[model samples]
Target: MDVVNLNQFCIIFPCYVMMILTILWIWRIVNWVWIRPLQVEKSLRAQGFNGNPYRLLHGDSRDMAAMIRDAQSRPIHLSQRNILPRVLPLHHHIIANYGKASFIWIGPEARVLIMDPLLIQEILNKNNVFKKPTPNPLAKYLVCGLSGYEDLKWAKHRKIINPAFYLEKLKNMVGDMSTSCSAMAKKWEDLFEGRMVIEIDVQPYLWELSCEIISKTAFGSRNEEGKKILKLQGEQAELTRQVLQSVYVPGWRYVPTRRNRRLKEINSQVCTLLRSIINQRQKAIELGHVKGDDLLGILLKSNEKEIEEDESNCGMSIDEVIEECKTFYFSGQESTSNLLSWTMFLLSVNKEWQDRAREEVFRVFGNDPLHFDGLNRLKTLTMIIYEVLRLYPPGVIFNRIIYEDTKLGHMTLPAGVHLLLPIILLHYDRELWGDDAHDFKPERFSQGIAKATNNQLAYFPFSWGPRTCIGNNFSLLEVKVTLATILRRFSFQLSASYTHAPAYVVTLQPQFGVQLMLTRL
Candidate 1:
């Protein structure tokens, strides 16, 4: 009788365990789809934020995807105000349809779109509560290292990387920038002989110019593999574009689909290239024959100094160093090139501004090879670059994920909600820039940035405060040198084949490219 009772008890235990597993699975499903969103939505609504009603399963993901696809399919004409959706659709649409401070659902997540500049200042300034979101895993695979870190890791990385981009360091890179721009101008001059109208988009040349500058300025003489690096960087950028188009599916990267396979393949190639560069740099460091103060040398020196003083004070591991190198190559090359291309494009259309910029360049340098101090003296040219950056910023969309409950404007946001700060929308905002917000007027920046927006946070081409692009000084110096050198050498006009389609990839780029007719003056 005792044995039979024991057997019956063991059978009941198995049944009880199965029931518990089933309950947990159901709870996860319910919480993910309904419970959490409902709670967040209720809280946001309580704060007086009005937005589109959330759809049960889809939320706003479907609409967002459709909008992205539709935008990519059409040709972008810069003359039109509605070339692209106003940065954040929900925020722009909510303001248009509802009012200021409306909510939008972004895939089981509800976010309050804060349009007020004062509110923007508060969020950007308060660093602890609002931080960069956990990056998408796929973004990590494609381009890992810098933008992937959050919280303490981010703070540490930023701290270590800060010294490399200081004003003095940026001054050191101006010569390389001048050399690159000079080489590119020579190529255009050859095509410009006999006043022939060459139908060429200057975008590709600008990209090459920026890549060469990054290669030389970062690696010095070690930039021997720049061509190979450029190829890998281009592939990585294209893959990122493809990844953005498709909705992310978990573990989908491991799947055998053609797109996934191709993406993985690109990832493998970039990894191999970066690994090779890392190996070369390490060997150079071991040999104790450090080159000039290029970016790589500075970074390695900084790392070594920290480790030698106190191992615990070391900012990053060897792996992190390589990742930062890759980030610098990609980000530095992409942003600066996009800025130059757009600046040139804007200058092309506005001939009066172009001539004025040329006069400024000539006045500053006077046939002397471009130098760091000379670049700074070109105040008019500097204002023009700032104006172009304001009009066509490379990083149009800035996203920050909320890690804790935070106050934004009048709303109290919960954890797991992402705040979308649309830099593109803010830059063009009439309330922020007055009636001529859309106009490309460099005079707005003549009095310096503080007085530009009436001391508002309306203009942030390089972002604002803590998380602003670390390389802004480096980028500006490069642009000033490149523009100065190019303007002194050749005069250009818009090519007939040029189409003004400014669109967003990872950065805002000329979709069809910036076509310009060149003539050596």
Candidate 2:
């Protein structure tokens, strides 16, 4: 009977093990699907906030997607809703339903929408709590350098990379910026066939300008390799767009699909290009052939200085430096180009404003070529550029992820949730800018941005606070200089063929291109 009991116990042991495993699995499912979300919902409810009930599996993704489709299919307008049906359909609805501060769910994720100027200011101020969210995984495939990293690694990279964009360092690059602008100005000059209305898509011209500036600044005299990197980066961006538009399966990054395979190939090519350029620069330095204040040289010197000052403040690892160089190459190219393109588009539309800007450009710059000091005096031009950025910001919205439960204004935010501040929506809020918010009025900003938004944190073209764009000064100077040069030689107007569809791809861009009729002034 004892032997029988021992055999029965052995049989029951397997059953008991299965039962315990099943119980653990159920607990995980319950915690993830119901219990955790309910706790978050309760916290939000206590704050007097309400949103759609979180579904077990889908959450609000399906509803959000449907609403976006419907809203986008309506019509494209100045409002944010018509911008990207697939991305922000809930944008219009949230504004309509919850006034300024509304909440929405995106696949078990709660994104609190803050468009109120005061709240936007508060969130942007608390950078410790409201840090920028990582882009979707596939974005790393496209811009896989500094913009992708997070946590301590990101902080370290940001520190090492900060010196390259100092105003004095950037001022030294003005000649290179002017040289690129001159090249584009020559292109426009060639197009002027004696009152000949040449239909030109300015995006490529602006893209070339940006590429050349990055090439000269990042690579200095050795821009041949930088041009190749630019080509591969463009290809990578295109491939990235294709990947982003596809259906995302879990672990898609590791899968061996054609898109994935092509992405890997392009990424390899881009990396090889960057590595070769870095090696060439290093070799030049070793052989004592390097010169001037090009970005790479300055960065190397800065890194070494930091190391000498403090062991703990050591320079970036070789791999880290390479990644940062790639980031500078890509970001520098994309941002300046986008700003130039949009500024030209807006100027084309508002010819009165364009004429006023041209007048200011001439008033400050005169017959003399653009100088650092002269660039500063173009106050009216600066106001016009500021206004353009306000309406057509490069990114529609920026997101901040909460790492812990924190008090935001009168509300308590949950961990793992996102605080989304829609810059475009905030820029267009009638209450913030009066009834003419949607109108293109540069004069409104003539008194400077402080008076424009009543000193609210409403006008941060390069963002605000400690993490504001490091290159804001550089970018603004480039924009002002480039626009002054272009206006000095040629007059432009929106062509009949032009379409006004703005789309977001790394930066907000004209989808159909900004077609303009160029005439020699």
Candidate 3:
């Protein structure tokens, strides 16, 4: 009887332990899916915020996705300047129904859309209190360098990478940028094939031009390898886009799905290539076989200097350096290509602006090679670029998450609430930009950004304050060079086949590509 009782106790005790664990897990899930979200909703509603009531674990995700699909189904006219509705359908709808000061649900998370420039200024300035939200785990596989870092780590990477993008350092890269642009121009001319005018899709050419420029400037002599890395990154960007479009399940990235497997494979290949390049560059630098002049060289040199100063707590590891290189490729390529594409499209449609820009380009350079000083002197071109950025900014929205209860303006936001600073909405806000906000008026920026924004933090194409994009100046310079070079050779108009559809995939891009009829000057 004693032996039988002991055996029964062992089996029964194990069952009891399993039951307790299962109950705890279920309770945690219930709290996350129901209780916590309701509590957050209540807090937000009490604070005068209006949005759709929370519904289970999905929140407003289904509606948001539906709205986006509906919006993308129809193409807006080329003459339509109010692209806010098309680019961000759900946000536009929410703001229209719930007013500007409102909240929306992204999964169980409550993301409040703050369009007030003053509050945005505070959010951008107070980086410590309102921090960058954790990015989608899968995005890290594509590119996560300085942009993905937070607090002290961000500072360290920014400090080490600063010298690489300094005005002086970028000046050294101008020649490479000019050469790449000239190459693209030659390719276009060859495609003309003795024809006076040719209708070509400039989007692909612009992408290629941007990619080549980044490869050469970022990697110097190892540019061929850089090109290979960028090609892989482009694939990774597309895959990541697909993943982001779908509902993201926690731990889904680890599941060995076909897409997941491909992403990992591409990531592995990119890392292998970058690691090889970095190792080779380091070896060459140590042997004094190469002068560290390009962006990578400057970054490596800066990292070494940082380590020498504070050996224990400074400098980036090899993996971190590789990430930054990936960032250089992605940001440099994506931003410039999009800016140029839109500039071409806008210039094509608005012939007066195109002529004015071309006139300015001719006056500055006069059929001569582009120089840094001359590019800066192209004031009209600068105004046009600024306007394009205002209309079709690369990043439409900026996100921040608070880790603790924080006071923003008059309201105290609870911890875990996310903040969204919609750059596009503020840009198109009639209150800040007046009634003609949506119109493509390059003249608005002629008096400079401060004068245009009335000294408020209204216009931030590359964002504003302490955490502004590090590549702002670099991107502008590349755009100027490429645009000036192209403007010098050809006068372009939107081709009849061109469709005016701007889609937001990773960044704002011409959904059907920017096709133009190029007439040789």
Question: Against the hidden true structure, what lDDT does model 3 obtain?
Answer: 0.89
Models ranked on TM-score: 3, 1, 2
Query: What lDDT does the true structure give each of the candidates?
Result: 0.76, 0.75, 0.89
Query: For residues 87-174, could you state the per-residue lDDT of candidate 3 as single tens digits?
Result: 9888899999999989988778889999888899999998888888887888779888998889999999999999998889889888
How far is 151's C-alpha from truth in model 3 (Å)?
1.2
Q: What pairs collide in candidate 1? A: none
Worst 10 residues of 3 by lDDT: 241-250
Model 1 Cα lDDT, one tens digit per residue, 1-521: 59999999899989999999999988977786789888888887787777777777567777766766666566655576443353334445666776766767766767566667787888788767677766555666555665767668877777677778877888767777777788888888787557655667788888888778888888764455665666676776777766654446457767787766666676677667767766677687788766647887778777777678776775688778877877888888889888999888888888899999899888877898878787778888888988888888988877777877876765668888878777777788887888988898999999999899888888888888777778888888888887887788767777767866666777888777888877677
Question: For each candidate, what TM-score against the reference?
Answer: 0.93, 0.88, 0.96
Model 2 stretches astray by more than 4 angstroms: 1-26, 62-87, 144-155, 221-252
Task: Candidate 3: count the clashes.
Answer: 0
Cα deviation of 27, candidate 1, in Å: 1.6
Query: Residue by residue across 194-236, what tens digits does model 2's lDDT show?
Result: 7566779999888878877787787775567777777777777
Query: Which residues of candidate 3, in runs, are more than 4 Å off?
Result: 1-14, 221-223
